[model samples]
Target: MGIRLSSVILIAASVGLLSNCSGIRLRQPLRSTEYDWRLFGGSETRTNAAPQFLEPPLKLVWSYDASAGFGPSALSAKDSVLFIATLQGELQVISIKDGERLGWVSLGSAIASAPVVDGTTVIVATADEKNNVISYDFSSARKYWKRTAGPVESAPLSVGRLIIIATLNGTLLALDRDTGEERWSIQVSQPIRSSPASDGERVFFGCDDGAVRGVNAITGNLLWTARTGAAVFANPIVIDSLVIVGSLDSTVYAFHVQSGEIAWKYRTSGMVYAPAAGFEHRAVVGTAHGDLLCLDTRTGRLLWSALGGDAGGVINAAPLIVGNIVYVGTLDKQLYALELSDGALRWQTELPGRMKTSPAVFGKRLFIPVENRIVLCYRSTSGEE
Candidate 1:
């Protein structure tokens, strides 16, 4: 059978079987040098850039059936374990090496935000009527604490001892990572659906009111707020002295990290929904009109743009930059790997469903969570093909 046909059959059979059984249990030890994807954008800055690169012709290594379809929440990895949250209110821990189900926790509510893995603690936010931010001890497989926040659709930000979350009720809350105790809360003018990006000192997030605000991480005081032409749904990526974000108005804005001053702005042909990923002097972003753009980080000048062609769908998931390759998944159930220097298509493949979350890369493997209840793994076989 063809690879796509086999993948569909495997996914169908695995989902039918795994839905009846409890999660898989594996005791594989983590590697010392393995990188951890602790946050939504891979760091407090939300750059969405991988530390290591994997070459083209990535071969399928393994696939895990999530049983239930995944939400917009992204996957997090630590050592060799992958933490995945599903729309069925389940948080699953899977072994990355062999795609074995390790363990899982049922949160009893839908999760739309990525889980944050910090050491042995895993933090996640749910989207129930009264949204909750729960912390779990992965080592003991027990709940640490559950705190109620507003309706949170954005992923929680774990910085040092604080857990930061933005709620749809226009609240930005900081809680103690260990105790789930509220440290501070600041109310913005409109709902905040974007995750907060931090640079250790201040936390940056965008609101539906077309404003991006920065608050002091320690005091919860509003430091500054910058306005855009439309609602800002994408997370802000902080690099150096600039805070970069995309808006629904089809514009990308860079604000001064400290002063909230507009450093530069770049206009695209479509509304921008994905977080911008930066590497070296360039920042890359994807748009709703199926356009991928690379811009000079310092000047906001368009370096190059690539059209996703006829099959390219809306690029909602953030683009992940690893070495010379830029990986992005589209709503059309296609994954594209573009050359970093120029937006040239190097490799593209059709997935089982839409890829709603950004992919995670560590060592030689790429982990992609699809909307079809399958997590696909690919290993780098760069020069072999």
Candidate 2:
């Protein structure tokens, strides 16, 4: 298949311009007591780390019925507001503090990718027959524009003044954040199901052809391409000068962001489909064989592997790191909180259904979306809350 582009005119309106295109800017300065999960992987880099410390013995804060089942789309939050997209073709805005439905709008298609929040605007990509990317103004409940980019299962990245999205047909489209106008587009050789990660200057993503690519965030020009052992299904995690990603060939590869040189590669026992979360000196990732491995961030050497009878389930969700603890969801319907230093199990909780969506953490609360239509909020009992 080839790349196809079309622009669909929706309700349009003028809005406040972004401060700059360097990256998404916060409406208010981030306070010490407030944290927002604004991107698919928590940020453009997709590290999936929470800013605050969250301890175990979590209490259920609230539960909201999604009406339709949740898919691979993760949740995004800003200023205590949660943005949830469902397979039922609905974009809902809810209160993070209490599960109240603040606002909602029908997108008219199934949404498998997470929505990105930039100030008062919400950007999302849909997977229905239209395969449209739409932006809306939350405050006014009006859509700024909608453009058909192709079939997109991957989440969109809102950086600077562009909304970057990759289609299943291997085309990466960069659209103007304010007008939804096409800025630039790049086509690869294979499908891109994994979400793209960015660091403002460049965007990184993996393809089904076993290639991890880097592109200029502004011009959509190819920067570098690194080949992996097998198809790359996990989102790339960009940290410092390296781009780290996992492949279905059971190996995790790290490439230099600038030169695309192989920094290190670690082989696992099973396919690595979930994205890796990084901390100080260690990176944590889960495998299909039900093992959680912690590796040296610089050397890719295995520091410790949490296996045996304790960790035996398929983990498709990326690990959530907060302080010294790592949280991961497994297909066995369990959520495990492990120590980041040694992968020791700190706590475990059973869920109502399989947990494939990564948990969203803010303040002292963790929001978990299950395969069922239920979204559960857990408040850390520790003094931090």
Q: Write the per-residue lDDT of candidate 2 for residues 1-385, one digit (tens) a residue.
A: 0111112112222333412111222233222224778878888888888656788867788999888876565598766667788888677767676887755666767888789887667888988546388886655545668898988888899879999989988899899999988999999889998899987899999999999999999999999999998999899888757898999999999899888999999989899888899878678889988888998878999999885245568988888898888988888998888888888888888988888877787767788999888889987876745
Model 1 shows how many backbone clashes? 1
**Segments of candidate 1 deviating more than 4 angstroms:** 1-34, 309-311, 383-385
Each model's TM-score, in the order given?
Answer: 0.90, 0.90
Q: Residues 242-333, candidate 1, lDDT per residue (tens digit)?
A: 89999999999999999999999999889998898988878898999988999998999899988656757899888988788898899999
Per-model C-alpha RMSD? 5.9, 8.3
User: What RMSD value applies to candidate 2?
Assistant: 8.3
Candidate 1, clashing residue pairs? 24-101
